[model samples]
Target chain A: MTNPTAAMLVIGDEILSGRTRDANMHFLAGELVRHGIDLNEVRIVSDDRDAIVTAVRALSEAFDHVFTSGGIGPTHDDITADSIAAAFGAPIDVRDDARALLEAHYARTGMELNAARLRMARIPDGAALIDNPVSTAPGFTLGNVHVMAGVPAVFQAMLASVLPTLTGGSPLLSQSLRVFRAEGDMAAQLAALADRYADLSIGCYPFHKDGVFGANVVVRGADGGRIDAAMSDLARDLGL
Target chain B: MTNPTAAMLVIGDEILSGRTRDANMHFLAGELVRHGIDLNEVRIVSDDRDAIVTAVRALSEAFDHVFTSGGIGPTHDDITADSIAAAFGAPIDVRDDARALLEAHYARTGMELNAARLRMARIPDGAALIDNPVSTAPGFTLGNVHVMAGVPAVFQAMLASVLPTLTGGSPLLSQSLRVFRAEGDMAAQLAALADRYADLSIGCYPFHKDGVFGANVVVRGADGGRIDAAMSDLARDLGL
Candidate 1:
């Protein structure tokens, strides 16, 4: 009756240092909800090993599935694979299948398979490789954690492979209507509407743009009919 | 000396449901770094009381300071003030000072402070009120967590008031340059650069855009002189 829950662990210093915004979290959140997996929480940590290990253990235990992005590349800061191995107490080595993929990729590109490049082939023991069609470096699923690259294109491709394997429930549907009224003005009636549609999650997000103050009322649920009913009622009552 | 470490707990179902992207984390991360605080972790959870309380307790214990956003509004979904109170086991009621602020603002604006608006005056015991210059509803500081508004304008305004009060260390400095090179080709030199400048955090972030595969190599440290020296050495060595 309930969807499986998931948490995302984004490992990177660039994000925490304010060099980049975490686009992966947003992308994964939208895709997970569409796949019928309820995203319960998301944690962004630096590239420190202890931080990674601790967060992995905590979120993995709390949710049915865990998706991690970042720190899985070839740079010196890339330590997600080793950290995931440490988190699960799994022995990690350069797996033959992963190495084969990397080796074939380098050969095709006329690049050397040096020791630094070989780091991409490291996978924790007993983990399954999540295919990366965008890049040859494979993301792996160890225990309940799916570790993928930080790069947006590669991460999206890896998720396309991993999401189908997981069990999901009915996809959540949402409908929204924007009204030119202050949130304070709409709070009471909105609360009443929320009470009437007990099955739906009614959320009012206020916005102030171009000297106009208004709110966007959104209703979400597993049933599309309930979402439509609530949204229509909201529109009729709010006169928008 | 280690700078004060901080974490952010974003409370909203909108972010987790993919309905909204958390712009506040990015904004806060940049501001905190400028203020010399190391933002080590960020967690985004839905607008659930138990989830908020548990995250508040965990992050509050782990970091020196915690900044929370969202769920502090007039609507029924705005449960942050009560949740923070529950997290600290503090009794919550309509604090007189908060009520006065709302009362005065409503009177001046010719709007009545109705029951829903009065909900904004509820504050936990012993929590200091955080001034909301844009809106009269004040955010509060209970324990180490600074509970603030979710709206970006109001959140930024509240932070301007809150930041000057906290003690800050030397600001973190960073410098970066873009080079049209694949991550695989640059991994070795980047690792060598990172090792040479152990005092700084040297990170190479890869990107694929407009049919160009390149990376931005960034160097960060508290010491401006050290960062400059490291960046110069990187430029000379990598021939960027």
Candidate 2:
């Protein structure tokens, strides 16, 4: 059976404006593959409400799960939470549970739970809170969308809490063979192999290292046996 | 005047599967902003035809320019060239100019211009050839979408050639101030400042470093004087 599909929506002007190179998309991609959920797509948009709502709506409907990073902070540009609420057409306000979490964290840290800080407590109706261990602000799961922080540490902590609770399929298995040759040299063989095993995904990634060319043929599938078979055939045929 | 808006479509299974960390997005993002093109969105999709076509069409129509990286190489999974043709309903085949470039390069490198290698020459009709100096394969531009190589060097080289040919708006100028305060502490004031300087785009990005919280207030706009004025006001108000 196919694995559950996921899409990531990264919300930030910092990333889109080249002020920050995003780490969450790659981190989530690796984590999702390890968790047996196929990451189908990833969209990074600016801190615009319309962009966020449109992208989140599209991704939430297209995939089994949608993980968003960034814009859930206590700042003018941090509009992701409200935008998400608008996308689902759900009413949002400062929930007591979320406020208490923030309040307690601020109390312990000797910081004020002011108007801006309390923005973190705003949760959409009927959404489950995803705990953030790195920071006090809790992420939330509204419908199929899991809105998390943009910070790498906080986003990781939130995903760690959310992933285990969700249903996962068999982990995707990958087998690879490296050949010190140009992609064109083995492209035909790889194509034939891909055709032979239509269920498996065979990818040829080329590299230039030490003034030499090489291609790494990776075979990915849900079945380890299928991946093994494809890799074995590939390795033997390539004389490796 | 507002900059020409652009979007990026990163087509590859390697990136989505967590095999490769995409460097092209950040590189292109930085380049575009410097070139006065506002990068609005970036989408990373797997090597699927329907997904590629859908994303390319949407991005191409939504923005003034759409830059796509990956899937233009000589591999079975590299379906970007064909997909772009399908997206614009343009016929694709081995174009003479592209083939000649590939043929001459292969001849110089002493590599056979075989069928698989020849796939690089397949350019869509009514498209301008993008010179790939790093590698022999010529990326193409069909309508507003500029199909570029995924390799860092090649992508940069193609961009260098393409950027000069396009009309660019005034270079977006940015001024930033770092304040040693939590985002919540300064968020309300920042919001007021944003309202005051409605024409300029002000972004407050928070950070946690060395057991302290801080936020970087950045003002971006086509008018350097406006950006400078906003930053000065923010600094004065925050006592920074």
Q: TM-score for chain A of every candidate model?
A: 0.97, 0.97
Model 2: runs farther than 4 Å from truth?
A: none
Tell how far residue B211 is off in model 1, in angstroms.
Answer: 3.2
Best by lDDT: 1
Encode model 2's per-residue lDDT on A64-121: one tens digit a residue.
9999999889987889889999999999999999999998999999988999889989
Candidate 1 residue spans exceeding 4 A from truth: none
RMSD of each: 1.2, 1.2
Model 1 lDDT per residue over A3-35, tens place: 999999999999998989999998998998899
- The alpha-carbon lDDT assigned to residue B223 of candidate 1 equals 97
* Candidate 2 TM-score, C-alpha based: 0.98
TM-score of chain B of each: 0.98, 0.97
Superposition error at A100 for model 1 (Å): 0.3
Interface RMSD of each: 1.0, 0.9
